[model samples]
Target: MSAHSQHNLPPSLTGKGATLALDGHDLVRMTEEHGSPLFVFSERRLRGNARALRDAAKGGHARARIFFASKACSNLHVIKALREEGLNIEVNSGGELWKALSAGFAPGEIVFNGVAKSVPEIELALGHGIQSINVDSAFELSRIAQVAAGMGKRARVTLRLVPGIGGGATAGIQTGSEKSKFGMGQAELKEALATAKANAAHLDVAGMHLHIGSQVLDLPDFLESVRFTAEQAKAIGGELGKPLQHLNLGGGYPINYVHHNPGANAGREFDYTPYTATQSAAAMLGEVAGAAAKALGPDAEIFFEPGRAVVADCALLLSRIENVKRRGALQWLFLDAGYNLLIDAAAVRWYYHMVNASRIDAAPDTEFRMVGPLCDSADCYFDVEGEYLWADLQATLTGVAGVTPEILAALKAKVVRLPETRSLPAATGPGDTIALLDTGAYTLEEMFQYCGRQRAKAVMIGTDDRIVTLRDRDRPEDLLDAAERQGIVRTVAAE
Candidate 1:
């Protein structure tokens, strides 16, 4: 009945009876040395993920290339590690581009992507002569052309098209649909092509780009997106009187968060098994190679800008329980880590599989409502919106004609996101180290200082068994340094 026996753990984690280790490093010991609420990454796992995606790309298309999305985990160490693995970078802003350069990526190995690019951002990209600037709209294309003309340099550009294909587990993550504000529509694409033709003096139309969305679970949608993009590229190339150089299918490859779940209340949406990089590549590139060949030339390259799948499962967050409270029929366990550390949990009802690192081998047969240290009511791990809808539906349907328990149960299944309660070791309580798995991607990038709490530290376990600090924990005095620097407040010496 141990959680390890019931759950599908990531390859980086191994649970023994009283201990949980990440890539052979003890979690409890790590927390004891670095303090609770720490982020740990495995270099071996990271390399494995990068190599797997690279191999999958090569297997699908001989000319395929991967550009690691720096917005996912911009830790310089993480970026440098990926760079060492021969993965290029895709940056969303001027800052990420600078970081990519600092991480040792060549200017030609970087691509810039963003909807609203400021003048300075455009200038910085053109100054460096990066690979391609993904043009989000016709206006952006004009702005880039103007900037390039002023600088007397030709800019490499790609038109981002919205294929109207919606993918991703949540609505917030969908980007390729026509309604999303991410890419150019048919009319805008035409305008962009005309503008590019006119500005041939300052612009070189290198390729076409389309990103379906992040955490995409649908395979057929990818094929449809590729076909649509290929059709657009062919037309655009014909109008430009030359074959396009590449097609960048934005990355939204999904990662499996829930390995095993027995609770009936746990929604099926949370337990989805995602396709591997190998399978996804074959489906997207191999299945649509013929269409790509017919549109672009056989030597044309395929580019991928993956952010989450490459890093999501390479790390875990370790937190310690601070307090335990028992109410009438419910028990609540409070953790030191909260929305400040993992904002997606509260912001989007994101789920990260939790296990008791201090009681790894014990039977996880006890249910408890897990809450964070934040003062906000929505700071808990449960899905707040889903719970509210479920409760409201029950109250509204009561005493209505033809309202049956079976109907209510069926409705409840769709409304609930995460299980109302989490099962952990019966003795799990205060002082126990809890490990949250698959937190490598967006947690650090999205984390912030809330409730006057300092941000957590991050460490990496190298393949050589060396533990290196990626980031230092924020200190108490460090919190006030910002205010003092801005001249808003000053700290006085203690009497």
Candidate 2:
């Protein structure tokens, strides 16, 4: 299979055993060209997704700047591609800030976000002269003003507010909760804006920002947030006697993964899109923008910082199978990637839908208890309703890496162990290939080396079916090199 064909792997792939065909090339091609346990991103799909979001916001009238949340897919290459398309950047941390900067994102084109900003980090941003920092607290505003005054520069600050409407289905992620630690309250925001006005000579209050939460599926929740933001801006304008320059409704739009389906193995579905047609989450955003214009007048520019929805479907993770064993009725299927590579799996119970990349239309007739190669027992993606099968002597493992801790715990508790088998065939031995689907977001930055294992490799498939190594697999020597830089001097005198 070629790279283009593999990149176009269908939504539902079916075949006996764990076979992965990405773009057009099967797991064999991916492994030979790139390497196993590789993160392959589709450039065509990425640009298309970005363009969709931009079009959604503009409604074909004017261009609406869409900032790719670097926190989602912070790979420099990923950032570079998005930047090339004229998409702005939204960064959550100093590391992401550096990535965006290295990817050629202009200082003025980036939006610095996050509730907690360290002094040194803030100083770095102040020095770099990024466009605006979304201030979460009155104290942050004070710090920015102080830092800006010290540097003899003005800080473009945006106040992040809690819209009071919970976002996403997960109660824990809903940032709009009054109890959440995300944005500044209305009272604090008022005081912060007042303080900014008092220090207008040193601080420039750029806009008001809000990120309700991630994986938000409900359009009304976002629209309501927009309306609330517009209303608040209007009230603030009344106090300041000027309409704010920017109103950023942060992105948390949901994507429909295979996990949305029922069953224990369907994985954890946080953001579910029951519909996927003409009126999508993007359309809802446009409606929200129109509503904001109505409430806050036409001058206020509404900004959206969407991360997952843009990159989720644009990338996939391909892994190779190592072993398959059956403990009593429980089947243990091991792969090459684990939580170390999928940092998000440690916290968020997000499961990327997986299927044989080779069998685009394969039926969901079999299931398996999928586990990674990590020594930790918590690393597993067990599907209670899924069965494992192998045919054609192709011994390969395929599935998404980075199963969330929540789901792993459930797997640990035997929530997805195989049921009594009537006449199931014996499992295949090692040497099979498995692939994980829709892992484009935060996998790379999250992956860490643990237990002295090899660092995973990253590959990119080009328009010409050529495979380019994005990040090479780490060797034991690489670890020693890293350790040497950490000032760990070797024992000169032998014991």
Candidate 3:
């Protein structure tokens, strides 16, 4: 809301002075009405992203579908909203499978994915007759066969090949590499396919799939992985005497997260545009489709599983400052929420732009340390290395003896070198709200009951321009339900 300059702001945010807005609604008022430490999602943004992906596919292959990655977000309302746009779903586990079903996704529209699938979950997937079970390992392929045999069902599958490609924002999220714990190596995947083909009584190795990790910045690497997957599919189909029916070039589109990095891409600093200006979905589809036609032959149905691109910029976390402290020369700002609300930020050093919601117009002159309410030292906004967790400022409590002002300024300058830094007004204090931008994806799926901090409320600005509660804030009893099950108290747990 700064009148100084409005450049590089996200499309969903607007307003001047102390009143920053989302979908035209004042965030301060929304927080007051819904409660602080909340997640506010823009339905408009969600639909736009979904449509952009679908459009990209249609434009590229003339027949493209997005199996919306359900693990990125599990909210029923959010799921239902995206499903209504004609997008399908991809679930990583039985719990997510249930949520997808509960969200009104048809069996044929749901694709189950995971490294390990328990017997009950496998049975559940078979019972529902989901679209396809993406087999991650040879053992998992055999496990599916056993379960399907017992259930007297024919389970469709796509072998997930590890191309050993790695390019992601963090090592934790890179799934397509052999160094990662997801999917199977190419030789193992080929062997699994042969085994499945041999045991055709219960399993059908009908397709090939490969994901070259997430946060992919280099488009060429991703395309190469796609080509490799198709080539593998052709080789396997010829060896197994079967035609591959589908190919899943899994989703890994990069979103701009760095807000102030010089020479960085434009609109990355709080930019929320869903589709690329030149790199359209049609372009990506055309590239993959052409490759598949050459290697796997024509009629290779295309599929993608987009999680981050569809929802990463659709929501924000609204937190309030509980205290601002200075010890010696260090300045600190403590928020009401912790890593419990957004685990990825703390665990993997994920970057999300922060704003002083209460005073968006004020010059961000303050360089205070940022911390969360969690007693654990790991719950700060800075990286896991704890590089900027504290100021080096040291002065006598008597105020008579203090560090040199010039030295203190130099140290503060060093803190700014880290990936994320917000310049909130110097007056920021208790009750002042902070908005963590670009939090729609990954945050909800990883939220936990750490320190018994209940999950916050999530409100949505609906398509009709009306506000409604998509999910109620987690109550205290929700967290205690698990502990109470151990006979620590009377035991009627959620399960």
Candidate 4:
């Protein structure tokens, strides 16, 4: 009847009676020391993920390069650890570029990628001589060329082509569709290539790049994307009269998030059979070997910019239940952590498996409506939008003519996002520590300070069994420090 016996816990997590340990460190004790609403990352998992990805890439192609997408988890310690494992860095903004440099990544080991690259960001990349700037559009290409011309430097550039292929869990994350505002289409790409050739003095066309989407579960979509990119590379090389130096197959490798339990109402909408790094690499490299090799030659490198796959499952968020309420036949458990800490949960209705850390061995026979401390109604873990739509549909169809029960059931199935309830220990309530699993990626990076709640602290469990603080808990003054710096608010001391 224990939770572990019923649920598939992550590899780094183990549960015993009244205790939940992450890689042999007790979660309850850590929460007691560090306070609730904390993030704990496992160094062992981070290094393992890096090694697995690197080895997988090498298995597919000898000249493969893996770049840890730092925008996923920009904590300096995490970046340094991945770098030590022989992965380069991929950044999206000037701030991320600076973080990459501060993390000790050489300019040659970094690649800048973004849609809106300001003048200052372009200058910083050129000044440091970063490996390549992944150009998002034709206009950006001309802008980069102009900036490089002004800087008196030849900027290495890669065209981010839109393969017109789209695959992702949600529309918000889908970046490769024809309508998506991410990369250049065929006409724009042709224009970019011509512009690069024209501005040969300032722009060095190094390679081509395309990102299908994040959390893409379809392997055939990857194969199709790789095949398309390879074909384009071949034609591009022929047009330019020189082979490409690299092919940046931007990463969207998925990771398993749902841990199934027969007795629990864990949402199945987020579940997918994620491809292993090796499988993804092989699919891409296999396509590359066919046509792309004929143009780029054997020495051409293959680059992967993995973000979520590298870190999503390597950490968990620990939250404390601060209050409990019961209405009719339902129970609600409110935790201290909310959209401010894990924005995706509210923004996209993202799901993270919840575990009762305080009662690890207890049977999860009770279903509770789990919610965060945020004042907003959408702050709960359930799909708020989906629930609203379902309710509206039911009300609309209540007296509609010829609306059969079967039809209503079918409509409800399509409208409802699963796991409308959460299964937890029956005794779960106030003061209980709940561990939200697989929250490593996107949570802290997208965190915001809303409703005056201070941001939480993060700690890493080192491979050496030492717990190091990755980030300190935000102080009350830290909130106003930004306003103070901008002169929006002046502190009159000792008034």
Summarize candidate 4's per-residue lDDT along 1-495 as a digit string, tens digits.
545575668668887557799999999999999998999999999999888888777766778788888889999999999999999999999999999999999998999999999999999999999999999999999999999999899999998989888877677788897788899988888899889889999999989999988888777777777788778888888888898889998888877666765665454342322322234433443454343344445688988898998899989999999999987799999999998999888777676888889888887778889999988998888877888998898999987999998888777656665457788888999999999998899877787789989899999999999999999998887787666755644445423
lDDT of 1 by residue, 16-105 (tens): 657898887889999999998999999998888888787777666778788998889999999999998878999999999999999999
Root-mean-square deviation of Cα positions for candidate 1 versus the true structure, in angstroms:
2.8
Q: Estimate each model's TM-score.
A: 0.93, 0.82, 0.86, 0.93
State residue 389's C-alpha deviation in candidate 4, in Å: 1.1
Tens digits of lDDT, candidate 2, 1-495: 322232333442223233554455566566666667778877777777777788777772243567788888787777787887778999988988988888898998999999889888888898999988999899889988888888898888888888888876445567886688888887898789788888887788768888888777777787788778878877777777767788888888776554333332232322223212224556666776666666656666668898888887777787776887878665666778777777554445445555444333333334456677888765665322322322111122223355555654444333222222111123423555456677887777777778777778887665566766668888766767656745554443332
lDDT of 3 by residue, 328-434 (tens): 66578899888898887677766666777787777665555678899798788764453434332333222435556665545544432333334667788889988
Prediction 2 TM-score vs. true: 0.82
Per-residue lDDT, model 3, residue 383, is 49
Q: Number of the top candidate by lDDT?
A: 4
lDDT of 4 at 442: 89
Error (Å) of candidate 4 at residue 16 is 3.5
The list of candidate 2 runs beyond 4 A from truth reads 1-20, 60-63, 259-281, 358-362, 382-429, 480-495
Model 2 Cα shift for residue 432 (angstroms): 1.8
Candidate 4 lDDT (Cα, 0 to 1): 0.84
Q: On lDDT, who's better, 3 or 4?
A: 4
**Model 4, stretches more than 4 Å misplaced?**
1-3, 267-297, 397-414, 482-494
Assess each prediction's global lDDT (C-alpha) against the native. Answer: 0.83, 0.68, 0.76, 0.84
